[model samples]
Target: MAATGFGALDGIRVIDFTQMLAGPFCTQLLADQGAEVIKIEPVEGEDSRGAGPFRPEDELRAFGGYFASVNRNKRSIGLNLKDPAARDIALKLADSADVVVENYRAGVMDRLGLSYETLRERNPRLVYAAIRGFGDPRTGNSPYSEWPAFDVVAQAMGGLMQINGPDRFTPLKVGPGVGDLFPATLCAFGISSALLRVARTGKGQFVDVSMVDAVLALCERTVHQNSFQGEIPHPEGNRHPLLSPFGLFRAKDGFVTLAAHFDAWWVKLAGLIDRPDLATDTRTATAAARVANNAFVYEQLELYTMQRTKKELAAVLGGKIPFGPVNNVAEILEDPHFAMREMILKVDHPGVDRQVAIAGIPLKMTETPGRIASRAPMLGEHTDEILREIGVGIEQAESLRAERIIG
Candidate 1:
C-alpha cells in the first residue's frame, strides 16, 4: 500500500464520527484525496461492518464488502462514546482535527457533547459537516432530533420513489441509494467549501446536507415540467420523455438502444435501416410527424431489429446511428473500454490471499491523482497508534483497552 501521508489532502486531518454508507463514502473520498481521516468507530464498529455480503472464507474479521467498498484509505480508532474517558479522548482528537464529519440525526452530537457549537468553541477553525434524512425543524421543542433513519426511508420520502419506474401504476426506487449518495456528495462539497472559508476568514462554519433536499434538487426537472408546461412527467419506461427515438428496442439475442434525436440523424437512420420511403412519408417526414407517429415508427424499427442479433444490429448502426447493446455485469467486466480506462482495480487484501477487483476512482487528475492504497482496516486495528498520536501514552492506551474504552 502507498503511504497515505502524501496525498493531496496530506496535511488535512478529518475526525470522522460517521458510519454506514453516506458519511463513510464522503470521508473515503477525502481519504483517497490524501486526508488523514481517523474514523472514530464505536467499540463494536459501524452498522455497515455487520451488514454483509461477507467473504465466506473469513467471517471473524470486519471484512464485509459493503463496509470495504466505501471505507478504504482510512484508519479506524475504536471509541465507546458512552464512556466518559472515551468521550474526552474524542474531544481531544476533534480539537486538533481540521474537519469533523458526522451523519447522526441532528441532535445526537449535542447529546454526546460533540456538537459543532461545542467543538468550535475549542477549535475555532474547524470545519464541521453533517448529513440528515430531512431538514431540521426551524423552530423545535422536542428531543426527537436524535431519531435515526436508513437509506431506503430517505429514498421513499425524498422524491426519488415518486419519479422513478415506468409510471404512476408502479413506482420503483432507484437501484442504488441515490438519496444517500447524493447528500453524501453534497456534504463533502460543503465540507470543502467550509474548509476554504476557514482558510480565508480563520473562522469555521457548520455545513448540513439533507437527503430529502438533495433528492428534490435532483428531481427539479420534473417539478419544472409540471409547473411551467402543465406536464406531469410520468415515467415513459426506457424512453426519454422529451426526445424521440431515444429508447431501447428488441434485437434477436437481446436489447439495443437508439438515440437518433436530431432530424439529420433520423435521415441517416432511415437510410441505414433501408427505410428511405418512411424518411419522406407524410406521417414520418418531419421531426414532429415522426414523434406523433413514434409508436408506429418504433414498431417498424423493432420489426427489422428483432431479426438481427445485438452484435449485428450494433455493427450496422455503429456511428451511422447512435446505438448501444444492453450490457450486463459480466459483459462490463470484460469490456475493452472499461479495462483501458482502468475503471477496475485489483487489490490484494489481508483477509483474502488472492487479489480482488473493484471499481476504481472515476476522477482523472494530472497532478493530484487518487489511488486505492489499503484495504479497509480490521476493527480497532490502529487504535493504539492513533491514541498515541492524540497525546495518549502507550501505558494509558493499554489501560483504556483494559477498561474497554478502546477495543
Candidate 2:
C-alpha cells in the first residue's frame, strides 16, 4: 500500500453511505482518484462482505471477492444508524464531508435522520449523490421508485437485454453487471461535475442517477434505430444488423472476430484470405452489397476461418484489417497488452496469504495518476481511528461499541 495518495481528488472527502455494488463502485472510483472516502457500514459489516468467492481454508470469512473488487482504496467504519447516538455521529461525519453518496430507496436516509436536506443544511456546499433503481423524488417521481431493482431487473427493463443475445425471442442479459456498473460510473462522473460546480458557485446540489435510465441511455443505438427507420432492433448475436463480415466467425481452436466491413478492409481481407474473387464478385464487392447478401458473406469468411485455428487466423489477419482471436480470462492475463495498460491489478486479500486480481483504474491522468492505494478494509477496520478523527474520544468509542452502536 502507498503512503502518498493520488493527488487528483486528494482533499475531497466522501462519506459513503452505501453498500452492495452500485453505490460502493461509484465511491470506489472517487477513492481510487484519492478522495478521502469513509465508508459507513453496519455494526457487523455490510451485506456484500458475506458475498463470497472465499478460500475454503480460511475460517475468518472476513470479506469476499465481490466486496474486494469494488471496495479497494477506501476506509470503513461500522455504525448502527438505528441508535440515535450512532445517527448523531453519522450526521457529524456528513457535516464535514464534501459529498455524501447512497443507493437506498427514496426514503431510507430520511427514516434514519440522514437525508440530503438535513445534511446540506448543516454543510451547505455538500454534494449529495443518490443512485437508485428509479431515482429520488427530489429529481422526479416514478411508479417504480419504491420497487427493488438489481442488475438483472435494470438490464431487462432498460432495453439492454432487448438488443442482445442470439435472436429477438431470446433476449439475454449481458454477462457483466452492466446495469449496475454503468450507472455507478455515471454517478461518479456526476459527482465530479458537481464538485467542479461547487468550486465555482460554492453551492451543493443533488446528483441522482437511475439505474434503468442509465441503461436506457447506454442503449442509445436501439432508440435511434427504432426512431429513424422504424426498426425495432432485435438481439444481434455476434453479428451487426447493418454490416457484413463484422462479427464472430468459427476457428478450429476457438472463435475469431473481425470488422472488415468497410470496402477497403473487405477488399484487403478478401485478398489476404486468398479470395481475391470476393473483391470482384458483385454480391460482396461493396460494403452495402455484402450486407444485403450477409449470409453469403459470412459463409465465405467462415469457409476460410473455420479451417484455421484462432492463432493461425490472427497471424494472417491481425492489424491488417481489424481482426483478433476471442480472448478468455487466462489469455487476457497472459497478454502483454493488459499489463502494459495496468488494467489487471492485484490487491492483498484479508484472511488469504496471496493477493487476488481485480480490475484497475481506467483513467490515465499524467500528473495525478490513480492507483489502488489499499485493499478493502476488514469490517470497521478504522472505526476507532475515524471516530477519533471525527472528535469522539477513545472512551466514547469503547462505550458505543459496548452498546452495539459502533463496530
Candidate 3:
C-alpha cells in the first residue's frame, strides 16, 4: 500500500466542490496536511480546465498553468449537479465525507439541493465551509453577492489597492491573487479547527471566509494607523510608516529591502552607511527621530546601497540586518534556499511528455511529510470510481455517463 502522507487530518475526508483559486487552494492545503480530498467537478469540468496558457499539444489535458498550480495531490470526480442522478451521487459522497468545501456564490448550493441544511440531515457531523467574495449568509446579502468575482475585482473593492502602489496618483493591485489566497488560507484554518471540534464532540460547524474580510484583516497596520492615531495611510512607496530603514532601497544592480526594525540594527545601519555621526545625532538618534528624518535617513542609506551590488549588500546584511534582495520569479527559481527546501518539484504527467517542475507542498513534518503523489486529475478521471464507492454500480455509472450526469 502507498503511504497516505496522513499527518494531522489523517482520517478526515473532504468533498471539495470548489473550483479555481480560493476553494482549490483551501483543499490543496488540507490534502497537503493528510486529508483525503475528493474534488467534485462539473461534468464538463470547471471553467479553469479550459483556462490557459495551455500546452500546444494537449489542449484537452494540460488546460492551464493556473489550474495546475493549485489542484495537485487530489482526486477529481465529475458530476452534473443539474441532473437528479448526479445530485444523488453528490449527496452520497457528502454523507460519507467529514467535510465539504465549496466556493459557490450565496444561493447556488441551495438551488442544487446540496446546502448544509440538507447535507447535515444525512450526516450531522459534516463540517460545511463556504468561501466568498464577501461574507456568508450571516452577514446578509449584497447586490454583488451573486455576481462572480475575480481577484482583481476583490483587490480593488476590498481596500487592498487603495494602500498599495508608489503614490496616491497610481494605485496598484497586488501581483498574485492575494484576495483569493488569503481568504482560502483563513478558510482552511477554520475548517481544520471545525474538524477538530467535530472529532471531540461529534458536531459539525459552518466555516465562512470572505475575501474582502481577509484583505481587511491583512491591512492591520493600516487599520491601527487610522483607528488609533487618526492618521490616514497613503501609498508611501517602500518605506514603513512607523519603522524607519525598513523598506526597499536601490542597490547597484537592483532593489533590496533592509528591515532594521530594532534600535541596535538602526545603529548598525548608521555604521554600514558610514554615518557614525547619525548614530548619536539627537535629531536622528531614536526611532522617533529616524521617523522624523525619514527622507534624510533613507537618502543616506540609499547612497551606500546604490554604490554596492544587491548581492554584495545581501552578503553584508542578509541575516545580520534582516535584508533581502527583491527577487523576481527567475531569481527565486534559481535560489539555493528554495532548492534546499524542495519548494520546486519535478512531476510527470501522461498529458505532458517531459517531467516539468511544479511547486511542492510547503508544510513540512518529520513523521508524515506530504508528497506529490499524482498530477491534477483529468476531468472526471475518478468519476466512476467515486460513484461506485458511493453505491452507484458500474452499469448505473455507465447510464449516468450516457445521460451526461457523469463525465
Per-residue lDDT for 233-267 in model 1, tens only? 66567766666788989899999999886789988
Off by over 4 Å in 2: 1-4
Candidate 3 at residue 134, lDDT? 79
Please list all clashing residue pairs in model 3, or write none if there are none: none
Candidate 2: minimum summed lDDT over ten consecutive residues — where? 1-10
lDDT values, one for every candidate: 0.81, 0.92, 0.83
Local lDDT at 207 for model 1: 80
Off by over 4 Å in 1: 5-7, 137-147, 319-321
Worst 10 residues of 1 by lDDT: 137-146
The TM-score of predicted model 1 comes to 0.92
Residue pair clashes in candidate 1? none
Pairs of residues clashing in candidate 2 = none
Tens-place lDDT per residue, model 2, 1-407, is: 12336758888999998889999999999988889899999998999999998877668889988999999988889999999999999999998999999999889999999998899999999999999998888989999999989999999999999889987689998999998999999999999999999999999999999999999999999889999999999997889998888899999989999998889998899889999999999999998899899889999999999999988998899989998889999999998989999999988887788878999888889999978889999988988989888799999999999999999
Give the better candidate number (2 or 3) by TM-score: 2
lDDT of 2 at 148: 89
